[model samples]
Target: MQNRQQSEIVRDILTVCNGSGTTITNVMFHAYISHAQARGYLGELIDKGLIENDIFDSRQYRSTPKGLKYLAGLETMSELLAIETRRIAKSGANIC
Candidate 1:
């Protein structure tokens, strides 16, 4: 598999936890990150108010509204970038 950036990993984690929430194992598997990495990113995301652990069940983590908004914005940006790239390629313009 190809390597992913931290932001991409965060996005994957959010996507994996978007609905009813999931276990840390699920996040790790889906996000393709190690346990240590997941823990660190989860901590940062929680501090940023992007994701929250279930109060009733600590093992469960879910994406908050802010997280969803961030995911949407990121997706939009990716789409826009893809469109620009395709345009550039079609025009035979060198990006550099």
Candidate 2:
């Protein structure tokens, strides 16, 4: 799979939880990606076992263990980013 932007990857993680069920199309809409790109990205995520597509209900997808791990990592990264931003602000870096 090609390297995707962090926002796209993060959005893919969240897309599975949408109440309407998880399809590549739904994920694309959630992630604000074009339909074609969503299909390719969803295929890569499935192949990596980070996501599992429901065999009984093709439109549904769920996070796998690997996907949960990835989400945790992303959360940690987000926390770190927030901390750094706060530190810079406190230092009067004028980021705003």
Q: Best candidate, TM-score-wise?
A: 1
Q: What lDDT, from 0 to 1, does candidate 1 have?
A: 0.84
lDDT of 1 by residue, 1-83 (tens): 55656767888889998999999999999888899999999999999999999999999999999999999997777666653
Q: Report the C-alpha lDDT of model 2 over 1-96, residue by residue, as the tens digit.
A: 345565545545454543434766667665666777767776777887777777689777777778778767766675666633322455776422
The regions of model 1 sitting more than 4 angstroms off are 83-96
Clashes of 2: 0
- RMSD vs true structure, all candidates: 6.2, 6.9
Which stretches in model 2 have alpha-carbon errors above 4 Å?
Answer: 1-4, 7-11, 14-21, 83-96
Model 2 residue 36 lDDT score: 75
lDDT per model vs. reference: 0.84, 0.62
For every model in order, what is the number of clashing pairs? 0, 0
